[model samples]
Target: MSSNQRKSFFDLSASGQKKRLKAAQDVPLPGSGSQSSSSRREEDVPDSPVPLSQPHPSSEDQALGHCPRSDELELCPSASSSDEYEIEDENNVEDSSEESSNDDDHDDDIGIREKLRNWASQYKITATALTALLHILTSHICFSSLPLDGRTLCRTPRNINTVEVEPGHYSHIGLKSTLIKLMSGVSHTINTVILHISTDGLPLFKSMPGELWPILGSIKNVCSLSKIVFPIGIYFGKKKPIDCCLFLKEFVEESIDVINNGITIEGRKFQVLIQGIICDTPARSYILGTKSHTGYSSCIRCKQEGIYDKGRMTFPSVNAPPRCHEDFLIQRDLDFQVSESLLVKIPGLDLVKNLPLDYMHAVCLGVVKKLLLTWTSGPVNKCKFPSRLVNQLYSFVLCHNLSAYCSILGFPNTI
Candidate 1:
């Protein structure tokens, strides 16, 4: 075994020490004159201090007294007077630290400008190519750009509230306070503001059953070109009637207050009214506290009973009720007595007149989509025209270059 692996006297037990001594008798001792024992002993001793020798100073450095001072050498006892001077020459030219820092900043600015220019050039090239490609594909490709100002980009503070009805169950932001704050902020310029609330069921995924009901509001005073919608509430999961009522409860109370007593903003008071709600048939039915659109007596305008004809509920020609708000307030056969809708509670908001049918859903999705699908590939009985005629019609529509018209119809390039 190597000497390093051998057990020391302190490490050995009483019996182990006797065994070590017997083993040591068998091993030959190192000669007295040999360096083996001296070397081993020297290995155990701490190293002695050595004199530090510095590099020789240049003639110019020596003349300038840049070499280590005598007092410095004296402070280090191990240093000799013959030790070379290691001090640097202070005469060497160099830019100031501040100047160097400024230069680095200038270089960084230049680098950033160059990168931006390159990126802009690439973007321009890409935009030009895309425009040219789109132009070739559709002759009537229209481009509309709206310039945004500080007012347009201004974001109002959001008040998010958590309501704990059950443990770990929290509600989203309170719609009443949020809407009041939003109205108060915009009351300065507008003397009167009309709000149009819209709600629709949005399926979160095509393959999943997850759904979200988002309530949106838009101001009527703003130009149609610059009109922006703000989200008031979002409910996840099944859109139950009770949940809908709960969501609109706060909003209804706030709306009544705003309509009765106008909000003051910057010393000016502005009257705010919830003019109407825009939604599809199903959502409208839910909000109006009426029967589903497919039910027997589903028509919202009239007391017409829909006939179950050809696998569909068809409403026949009937004398509809007067287009008045009070008509809807009068409870119908299917009206929910327990959970009354917010639409009926809020004053000035005409349930019948204010709740206009969304053209995008009623006309575009309901009529146009059905007609298109039928023309393209529906049952022979339902198809509007022959396959050859439908193809010819499609080609004609494509040739006409009606992108703007199609866009207005809510289906661009659908032909």
Candidate 2:
């Protein structure tokens, strides 16, 4: 029969019809009828291997408790059962969020401690010590009133009995009393006040031309160790005033009165005297109304004539008579001499004796530095030692185990 004319067993629903179809299928063809029934049964069964065509379990199905099996379709959980799992997951998420918040709070605490430690370490302080120091600083104990080494000098009981003087035209009255009060506890015996005046040009700005000439005064007895220079007056301008005596007129008048009539301090009379003036070369010349240090006759000690060579004026060591106050008075009419200087008018004061050589300028800077430069650099121009042999001599000194002493004298090892 043709394939289209064949009937299917599935078209009938009766059990007898299905049994007849099963028997028809079981009846073997003519060529395959020789096989035994047990062999046929074995052939009809499938091999016991894993099914390759089975669908995989999806992620959602596995989350809902489902298995990947064709015969187990009821393994998936119902909607009501899955609700409990979702609620549990939400609770776990809340727990995790709370744990993170707690961790952040702990981290914030750690960060605060770290910042405090860094702040203390920046000022070189330990944590425990810094806490104690802050407590002490904020306390109301008036620690500033406590006596310190150098700070307690003027505040001592012996120096406390002060006599306040009224303001005067030139200076504060009772100045002598205040000074004696400061020196009361000192061991040095002071019967009179010997004042030393100092003046210097202070430049106001580096690029500008203005400067200030300040006159300073200090007690001569205590000046060596405690040379405190108090400002008396300040003259400001680009150039020095033409008449310095006029600017110092009030000070001079007050000093004259103090010298003539002694000042009373704490009911005790103390005599005052103008000792001398201390200044550098330029300031000294300007104040004393003398020729500049570079002038032809610039030597204050003697009447030696200076020769101008190259760009500098050099004075030779000649045996010339020293100028005195009488000589200054006699030569006041001369064109070179300044007759109107207040220094010449001060009685009982010898200009020559009063004005001494400034050791720092004349000896240390001028002589010593010149000698060192000549020794090191071998007198390139207008230096004392014009020969290179001086440098060799210096090297020889260095070679002879005198480097230590040379270093003390400001001589470098390399040059």
Candidate 3:
């Protein structure tokens, strides 16, 4: 070691005074003569008392002064051996400290991962948001081992198979697996899932002929609000499916399996019941293999014969005999059902009873709105309201600020 390094290393010991005494005895006078030795003793001893104002040399300074110089190589051989031992001790301490630091870094990484996952779940954060956050973190912090992609962090599957129901047409996402995933967290002993199925044709654009028909479902009496609606099947076509039964074949088969055998979730089997199938008049007619809404025997609830009115078919009877499941099974009315529906294959499903009239079509957007429009804007007859009454109604609507209802009435500008 250098002279400065040796001084610093020996300074850690409390034996500085003993080492100085030993060094003075071992180191002989530079010249071989009595005169030289007498001169050295005189130089070591002060001529007069050190002035109090000048201060005294500290122990550290004394230790440095007595430290062996490079030219006196043969004088002190033990100091070199002592330095090697201290250096080895320092190297071992450094190794252990590095190991401990590595462990701390690993724990920190786990903590960061758990915190991010909890934050994402609590806020229902999107993948894009997580990806942005990860980019910022990786740019500023040194965590190259952590996943950079949001999908990987979110644990999203990469190899999901898309089932094609028809060529360039429909796709079926497995219903059984979806149900298991959705209901896996339920803690009930006897789980009962009441499912509601709905389907409708969706026009993609007004300028294009392309359209989509997705079969969606929801679980009734489910506590979780986030998973209300899920897709079971979807179809893209220039027009509606050629055959309704073929379109619904996959869905019907799945429904039958779920209702009869039940599905296992988290090692517990859940009994699924088909609560209802909801659809508008046109969609309902298409799925049930019945005539269109304009047909004379289009009403699915009852066997009420429709009469030809001023411009269209109208069902005026309020107390018509209700249609039964037996009538549907037997195909009692030839005019009503054009073909058998695929829904009949499901064991416990009722074609007529289990199919409820959709609220959006049967009430809010259909009967009530149409009746109001007919009374206000129809031909001048008993159905048309008086001019004074129509003005009062318009004023009432304006006073209430019922813009949403007026907009749905399709007369926002006129009103």
Q: Which candidate is the best by TM-score?
A: 3
Cα lDDT listed for each candidate: 0.58, 0.61, 0.76
What's the TM for model 3?
0.63
Clashing pairs in 2: none
Which 10-residue span in candidate 3 carries the lowest summed lDDT? 45-54
C-alpha lDDT of candidate 1 relative to the true structure:
0.58
Cα lDDT tens digits for candidate 1, 114-214? 55345545566454454454344345322111112211112224554644221122245544455555555342355777788888877777875655666
Distance from true location, Cα of 300 in model 2, Å: 1.4
Which number leads on lDDT? 3
Quote the lDDT for 48 in model 1: 24
Q: How would you order the candidates by lDDT, starting with the best?
A: 3, 2, 1
Residue 244, candidate 3: Cα error in Å is 2.2
Candidate 2 matches the true fold with a TM-score of 0.49
For residues 1-415, could you state the per-residue lDDT of candidate 2 as single tens digits? 3544433332335675546434644666466667975565344422232343556666565444333332332234345537877999999999999999889877765664455456665676654565565455436453332223222212224333222121111222233444655566555556787888777777789997776666677877764425665666556667665566665565566666677887765566778877888889888877777788888877777877788998998876677777777767667424345545676665556777888889888887788887777765654555556457666776777677655454344444554
lDDT of 3: 0.76
Of 1 and 2, the candidate ranking higher by TM-score: 1
Output the better candidate (1/3) by TM-score: 3
- C-alpha-based local distance difference test score of model 2: 0.61
